[model samples]
Target chain A: MAAGTTSSTEVPAKGAGFPPFKTETFPSQIFWLVITFAFLFVVLWRIAGPRIKGVLVTRRGQIDGDLAKAQSHRADAEGASAAYQSALAAARGRAQALAEENRQRIGGEIDRAKADADAAAQVEIAKAEARIAASRGEARAHVAKAAQDAAIAIVARLTGDTVAADEAASAVRAVTGG
Target chain B: MAMNPMEQFTIKPIVPLHIGGYDVSFTNQSLLMVVVAVAASLFLTLAMSKRSLVPSRAQSMAEMSYEFVANMIQSSTGEDGLKFFPFVFTLFVFVLFSNFFGMIPGSFTVTSQIAVTFALASLVILTVIVTGFARHGIGFLKLFVPKAPLALLFLLVPIEIISFLTRPISLSVRLFANMLAGHTMLAVFAGFVVLLGGAGGVLSVLSIAPMFLIVAIMLLELLVAFLQAYVFAILTCIYLNEALHLHDHH
Candidate 1:
């Protein structure tokens, strides 16, 4: 139930005053307020406050550590890439050197084989020249024997006498200039 | 049907107790204060029980509120102001929960009482004065002295001192008046609905008007509740900033 406003004046009579302005309740309200508020402050300061701060600090430290780990991983990857590239280049240089050496060796072998074939052809030409000279000398001697036989037959028929073998030979020698 | 709008602000003692001849009885006001404190504590503590690297929905909410207050203090008072973080955080949560809980119909709005608001405001001002003196020693008095000429110092100094003295009054009155006025208006409109509805015939139908108005006022009150709490916390920060860094504003 609601209480009616007392009298015409703004102030209400005793025990019916505006509840907010009532002085009697002040001590109790302040007393309890102080107690509850102080309790709350202590709870927050001791328990809740430290817990929150710890969580936040831990999260920050973890993030920093993770970032540092990521940075090192990236550096390791880069180093590996550089090493791989250098190894590939060295391998390529070695292959080229091997190819160049093989080409030079093959070129020298081809030049030596050509020189041996040229010297064998020169020896066969000298042997054929020597055989031709010997054959020419034998042919000239056969032609001189045929001429002497023909000269002896002609003397026998004309003089009706046989000439001496030595004389015939001398005659033949003089004519042919042997 | 004609109810007194002021009836909602009444303080009835739930459990009577006499301590040293003073009436420190447990009242409805006291009940809500305990509830607010417990609820705020549980909200933060239970939500953070897991303490996972990645937060859950409840945990995120807890963290967000913590960071929200933390950032507010940081921006206004800088990092050094963070030393008072627990105090500022408690004040914000208490006022916020009290306002929200009061929105539930039939629940008491503790901040509406001048005693409670005044106590809170006084605590803030007192902290400011103490911190200023502790940090700067005698230099704290320089807060009232401006960089003006010698002749204008006399006039400006008094004005500054008066404003400084009235900080608690203004702070307390702002929250109390807003809550009291808003609640009172809601009560009055709700009373109008009952009155009009009981008048019978066409008057009953017209009661819908006041009912709609009540809804609108309620929405506004919700906004007011949050705004007042924010205003209280921010003003506290600004005052603390002044105490911490006197003459830095110039």
Candidate 2:
């Protein structure tokens, strides 16, 4: 099979276009193959390899960037949800506190009103008692004065004009049938 | 009539040049390789040069060829495989044009010859070697060894080594044998048609049957041409896999 290297059929004559290499020589096809291989290696290493590497690197970076962005967005969304929850709690607390304060204030006002009413009623009752005492005293004084005047008038009529003070009292008592 | 149509399948010299113990003959085969290479480069470059957004017919053809290589790379090696697009493209175009060109009468099929196939196979192996070395450095030698159950290494290492060496041989033989056998059969059948012909010879008329069979075989050969190119590129990808993913201990 080594002689299978003789790829040419047969060399006929001088003018025949025999390949530069013997049929048994290095395969001419190997020459072309080497040339092709070298050319491709250079082409790929220089142009295509760099481009492909660039694309792969860029794609990787893009994926990494996207994942980072997604993570950040998730954090932001969580923060927003927490903020909303806190705000809602604060608003509810404020409303409840306001209601409680209102209830306490109303309670304080009702107590004050009751105290004022009690004080006013006490003052009114004291005024009524003072008025009743003053009227009773005046009536007692007027009754005494009227009784003495009646006694004097009866003594004068009975003793005609010459009766003495001591006699007059006694004569008045006798005249009136006391 | 020639004794055998296979006999006519010869590579005689067209121009003989001798240089110091070197038998340098410019033969039909060499001329055809030059033609195949030149035509491939020219056709693609000329057709794709304008780079129009809306492709012209020539540009469409160029784009189709580009798409073909690109798709082949993607399918064999996955999308990450697009990195090898240009190399794969050039190889496909060269082989495709050469195979089709060989089908023409009087044209030499370089790929049909073992030397040509061997050269191509060697290139693939060389790429694997260089890429593995470049990618893995000295660690590439570790490809032959199993890192686990040291006893299993006894069983696996030699087989692994043999398989590794066999890549180029199998790659070359598969392409060469298919191309050579197909062409030879066609020639042998054509010879039958000629040798059996004569007046009142029923056997001569029956020779037409082989001609029909040859036509069917030719169609099969065309399919083989595409298939062989595909196999070569895919095998390159598999070899590249070794470079990308080093063997685990197991």
Candidate 3:
């Protein structure tokens, strides 16, 4: 009956001034609230909560596993380095021992060679002395013979007598000896 | 033109429903809450579906929310208070998203509603009371009785009991008042911009200042939204912790 009186531009009358404080809407709002809050709580508690928690737990486990693996690897590396160090030290000690042994052997060989050379030089000196003595004796005999001949020639020329060569030689030899 | 800022708080049914003598229509406020709740839940679900060790950006967000609430609960309630993790988590995310949704240009802020906030606050109080009784038996009454001297009980007990009774009101009013005041202030300032610019003079240019202020306030509101959610969740955790600890020691 009032349809003809309603106007389009007229702003419709609102129920209450402040809707939040409106007693009428309270039940519906709270009703929807209970439903929505319950839905959200269920979703979080049953699905979202556990899933996120699983991811977290998995990530943490992964971290802990990786850390343990890294620690083991580090320990292995330290052990390897220790072994390498010990091996190097042993090799250095062996090299020092080898050098000492070689030096001692070479020194002993040098001392033996020096002694042999000294003995050969002494033999050579003795042979040379013997030969010099022999040569000197021959030279003296020759000089004695020559001196007797000269003395005989001189006596003969002065006294016309060729005395016995043996006697002259004997006299020359005795006079030189004296 | 004196725009009514209070009108923005009015609830109108987008889809009207009448059951018996009751009005349970899917109103704008309910719609706001439903959409926010569903959207938030869906976002978390989709983000965490992968559960990647190396989280995607969305997954990081989901994980951040999880850890943020989880850690807060742990600190306040320790391991035991985690029993209420679902409740606290749901409350925090819902209020947080609702606050943020309200920040949108013309969206309704569900948390600003006294009825809604009071309902949530009442739920927390109910949980705390039930939990306290269940955990501590009849000794839970001691909560109203402070550990001070008997003469001091004359002053302390009444204070403790009154404060306890006021918890729900305080909690609800805090969130409701904050959102209500913040939104109203923004609307008032926006109304200023409209009025000043409508005046069409140097005042139009002056509108820029309020516009900029509104932007800054918006950024502040974003922080406030998160902060309020954090406070609500942490407080819930602390209350639950009190129920679990029951006077801290024998």
Best by TM-score: 3
* TM-score attained by model 2: 0.59
Error of 3 at A124 (Å): 2.9
Sorted on DockQ, best first, the list reads 3, 1, 2
**Candidate 2 residue-wise lDDT at A28:** 40
B1-250 per-residue lDDT for model 3 (tens digits): 5355666687878898877878999988989999888988998899999889999999999999999998998988788878788899999999999999999987899999999999999999999999999989999988888778899999998898898889899999989988888887787788788878888989899989889989988888888888888888888887788788877834
Quality of candidate 2's docking, in CAPRI categories?
incorrect
lDDT of 3: 0.87
Q: What ranges in model 1 sit over 4 Å off?
A: A1-15, A93-178, B192-219
TM-score of model number 3: 0.91
**RMSD to native, candidate 2:** 12.0
Worst 10 residues of 1 chain A by lDDT: A5-14
Report the lDDT tens digits of candidate 1 across residue range B1-250.
4667777788889998788888988999999999988888888888888888888998888887788889999999999999989989888888988888888889999899999999999999999999999999999999999999999999999999999999999999999999999999998888889888999999999999999999999999999998999899999999999999997954
The candidate scoring highest on DockQ is 3
Alpha-carbon TM-score of each model against the true structure: 0.78, 0.59, 0.91
* lDDT per residue (tens digit) for residues A1-178 in model 3: 1122233222336453465777888989889999999999999999999999999999999999999999999999999999999999999999999999999999999999998999999999999999999999889878998999998998899999988999888889788882
For each candidate, report its DockQ versus the true two-chain complex: 0.32, 0.05, 0.39
